[model samples]
Target chain A: MNRETAFNLVLAAVLLAAPVIAFAANEPFYVALATRIAILALAAAGLNLALGFGGLVSFGHAAFFGIGGYVAGIFASHAMYSEPLPFGLPATDQMPVIWLVAALLCALAALPIGAISLRTTGVYFIMITLAFAQMIYYFAISWPAYGGEDGLSIPVRNSFVGLNTANALHFFLICYAVLMAALALTWRIRDSRFGMALQAARQNEVRLAAVGIRPFRIRLTAFVLSAVLTGLAGALFADLNRFASPSMMSWHMSGELIVLVILGGTGRLFGPVAGAILYVLLEYALGGMTERWQLFLGLILLGVVLFARGGVVGLVAGKARYD
Target chain B: MTEPVIEIHNLAKSFGGLRATDDVSLTLRRGEIHALIGPNGAGKSTLIHQICGTLMPDSGSIRLLGQDITTLDAAARAQLGLGRTFQISSLAPDFSVLRNVMLAVQGRQRSSFRFFGNVMADRSLTDPAMKALSQVGLETRAAIPASELSHGERRQLEIAIALALGSKALLLDEPMAGMGKDGSRALTDLLDVLRRDTPILLVEHDMDAVFALADRISVLVYGRIVASGSVAEIRENPEVRAAYLGARP
Candidate 1:
């Protein structure tokens, strides 16, 4: 196989195997570390659908990610207290139910945000999306119903069907599976007709209109779908940390998600995975060396932007054939 | 006569102080190539924009298939069977030739919202796109990225995309702008055949291609139609000669 293919395969293998090896060595912290990478990568993958494929540079994806986290946090808290959710739905600390709720909430929130943000383009679009996210962020911080700025903590790990999700290895496998499934979905979208129209809209909206595709609708749909996926990641992340707070919706989280996508490769299927792995590794490696690790990270990001036009995937795999 | 495929009446547009499209009226009938020719900055492109719904006119109306489309946006007008090509080639440069045309085909299909199916393996979209590509003689190059195509090939790809849209009428803005002698001649021959199935409102500056293919010619000067008639009539019109053709020779 070619270098890119080989690199991609090895990367996937290492991500899956490293966690297993760490669990066997009785270092459960490394397993959690791997799970963190998968969750973050999943979030970035969602943003890539809109930013990379749809040419929509959203600066507010953290809104969806945070919403997802809150969904898990709120549900688990209500269950722990033996209280029913509003509208008479009983709270349950079940992973599938939490994921569904998170996905649904994110979809509902994304619809209006996408509809409004899509009416503008360029800087206006970026600012509008960021404005929406910031609105949510401030709301979360001020609202005291669920710990507000302090955040809510889950008493225990949520349960999955026929499995003890509390086990680090078990939870890592779940996150890894979800990440793989999301990667498969990304591959499907990149090669599909809808994907083609989305990519076309990014390249030239005028041309897309001339051929009779409404760019606004295509982008909005992509935006919502991206939010749904990111929201799912957020739910998983809340479970991983056993806590959720306003920090999840911060603009920095959104910026970091965008960075991960760019660091991997803008439009490649595995770009988010590669980017997340490297970012977490660097954060861990560099943070241990010095408290001013961000300076080094910034320098490295500048280097990638200047020298490697395609991010890590571009450096390892070469220019994307499809893009 | 049966209604023209597209009818524009007294269409006027202005930019600040200048009237880019001044009371322009034109029609494209079935089985005909109506060429709109003018010197540079005569507002040929502006008038096309108004017809295709990119730019709204200050006054007047555009009707397609006898439906008032004056207020429709570009995508709405396109959905009503209006197809267009830009003066500068406008294709998804990063896409393969086949994929570029496939997008147009998908646009015309019901519900391009299908997200799960494998579009690459779907025959319904690919088949029609390939057929359109073949019609424009670019079928063999379908695998190549559109940006990789030569200038002449890119022009052909634009037409192929237009055709894939199942456009009842086409707005071709300077299709021959950058073509060589042989390339222009080949396109002229293609238009001759394409006109039978879909009428074209061609805006071009290439005199040879215009004289060779126009079933009717309209000369625009400062956004006004100076003279319009059959080839022989246009050649004899003194105003048309003075405004445009006189400067050519």
Candidate 2:
């Protein structure tokens, strides 16, 4: 195999092994840390679909992420209180059911956001998406139904097909599996006909139209699909922390997701994973060293943008054979 | 005579105080290359844009295959068998030559919403794409990215993509703009054969290629069709000579 493929395999192996090793060593915190990497990578993978492949710089993905988190938080809360949810549907603590709700909610939310935001391009697209996210952020803070700015805490972790999800190892495995699945899905999309059309839309919407594809529809579909994946990650993240708050939907979260995608390699498959590992590790290492860890992170990001154009994956894997 | 595949009637477009396409009308007959030529800023591109639905006219009707398409968007127009190439060589630079054409092939087939199948492995898309590339003599460079191709090759790739879309009519804008003598001659020959199946509305600055390929020539001056006829009639027209052909031999 080529160096890039080898590096990718090694990274996946390391992620898988690190958690298992930590679980054996009785270090639940390290296992949770690994789970955080997987979940964050999945979120970044979602953003990469629109930003990297579709050339849509959506600066408001945190809205979908927050929506997913709220779905989980609200559902768990209703179930804990033994209260019926809206529309006569009982609150569900089943992981699969929660995932379905999160995905559907994200798709529903993304539709209107994408429809309005997609009408503009370049800086306008970025700002409009951010605006939409901010609107949601403020709404979440003002709406006291769920804890508002202080956030709602899940009394208990959600169940997953009889698995002991309270065990950090079990949760880590689940997140790892989902991350791998998301990675595979990203790869499949990169080679699919829709993927080709989406990339074409990014490069030249006019050319895409000349050949009979509606660039707007293709991008909107991609945007919704992207939101769904990120939303799934958010659901998992809420379960991991047992909390959902306005911070989950903040503009800062959106910016950080974009940063992760860029840090790895915008369009590369394993770029998000590599970026997540680097980002989380840096936060741990630098935050432990100094309170102003963001300054160092900013310097590193500047270096990546200026000197390492391809990102971590690009630096190690070399130029992509496909693009 | 065969019916015109594309018919534009009383088309007019204005930018503020400037009339870019002023009450212009034209016809692109079946199985013929109708060349639209004029001096720079004579609204040749503007007229083409109106016909292609890139720019809407202030007043007029455009009919493609006997269907009124004046109100349609560019994508809707293309779905009705209208294909176009830009003067600036627009393409998916990140996509390989084969994949670029594959997108066109897929456009003509079922919906592009197929999210599961690996397009690279799908013979239905690649086979037709490769066939179109072969027609444009770009099959050998199928694996190379569109941005990696030379300027002349990118032009050829444009034709290949149009062919893959199964276009009934082509709007070629400056297809020979940046080509060398030999490249232009090659493309001219390709167009000569291509017109047999698909009619072309060719907007070009290359007078030699135009004269060699256009079955009918329309000269536009200041957004007006100053002259329209066969080569001999256009060559003899005093207005055409005074406005455009004067610069050439």
Candidate 3:
């Protein structure tokens, strides 16, 4: 069959199977697990915009994700108790308000980070981004205002405009819908004029410069946009779990996001999704079987990187050029 | 007279103890093919680097279309319509040939803040990209990866890329390098056609193509211009022959 036909069939099958798989596993538990996968995938997908296409291997995404989580947790803690937030704006449990704050915070934080990080390329960029993340991670652990190492808890999930977010299954569907919408948006931008320049910049900075495009400006814009998307996912993740922690900002979380992108197929559209599903399943399966499953997990990760050029998407769907 | 596209005055460069470009002055006029020729270690490449803004001269000033542009970076220079092709390396070999040219075209048009969806839908990117490939005569192999193209085709693609950059002038380091007889002929024809609009600064080793295509030839033996005149004038000048031709003698 031709490519378009095959793509249509694959998309149809996946959409058809989503609910069936969620339903077969049971009520809240399976649905909740799927929700977690969707949230993590969303965060990873944001990273993919930079890491996969733009080739910015930033190990600092977790800091943005965690910052987003804290915005939700902090807002809920103040709102549920009818207290005033630091700026005297009444604490808002409204999900839309919280998401906006999270996105803005993430984007603003990314500007300077991008400015400094973008001056260098490849290894230096990676290390500098990681170092900046570490600085924030350390600060979060030290700051005792919101439980510090223990993290802060939200008594209740944030409220959406017309619906209750307290219900587990309803919340699952909400998060899933957002994830799907994000992937669709990602696909659109990847094919747009701006994305064309970003991809070109990634492929050849010198040539791009020779053609009147500045690589620094393009990369910085992409870096900020990528951070904002991940921050949105982080906010959702906090409300889902009813907590936000320093662990979320840790270097390990950043590593896991990178691992997910690589495991699924670095530049493929579904790489983050496939990686998240497989990783979550592996964690669940191995945790049930043994305490030292991480060692085995490391082995599998090595195999994926060394042996498999393309991830599960390549395995099941086929090779995709624009990742 | 129309202003020279590029002008250099008293340009000097020193790498600690060695003088790479010494008191050099030259002008590239509109619609004229200016050629820089010299033997090995004659600093032709260094001077080209200085013009392209990769390296700044320790002393001197440069003007593009009567505006001083000595301090601008490469990207800034390009935005002012100074196009360049690398002498050694090529574009990303892993990406498709169409992709390579599409990138050059995109570099001229978009903001780079884009995220989401397929970039293939942008007609603005495709149109010029196709035109560029057509100019290089590689429209038929646009889908193939750049690494897969033959060496000669890569050279053509390089020119196509410069064309896509929308520069009014092209600084080609050496178009005829490493090409066989047929490849050289192909490139010579391309340059001949290209000179219909954009001026080219040809830095070449091929004496035949240089004599064939250059409107004016400048001979540099030791970072100083020894001769500058029409090709026929240089072919008959004893000083030009003593400085360049006599060495091959």
In model 1, the Cα lDDT at residue A113 comes to 98
RMSD of 1: 1.7
Instruction: Point out where model 1 deviates above 4 Å.
Output: A1-6, B247-249
Q: Which residues of candidate 3, in runs, are more than 4 Å off?
A: A1-25, B110-119, B233-249
Reported per model, the fraction of native interface contacts reproduced equals 0.72, 0.78, 0.65
Q: What TM-score, computed on C-alpha atoms, does each candidate reach?
A: 0.97, 0.98, 0.93
Interface DockQ of candidate 1: 0.69
Name the weakest run of 10 consecutive residues (lDDT summed) in model 3 chain A. A7-16
**CA shift of A61, model 1, Å:** 0.9
lDDT (tens digit, per residue) of candidate 1 on A85-158: 97989999999899999999999999999999999999999999999999999999988998888988877888
Name the runs in model 2 displaced over 4 angstroms. Answer: B247-249
Candidate 2 per-residue C-alpha lDDT over A1-323 given as tens digits, one digit per residue, 9 for 90 to 100: 89888989999999999989999999999999999999999999999999988989999999999998998999999999889998989887998899999999999999999999999999999999999999999999998989978888988988799689999999999889988999899888888888888888988898899888999999999999999999999999999999988898999999999999999998888999999999999999999999999999999999999999789999998877653
Q: Residue B81 in model 1: shift from native, Å?
A: 1.9
Looking at model 1 chain A, report the run of 10 residues with the lowest lDDT sum.
A314-323
Is candidate 2 or 3 superior in lDDT?
2
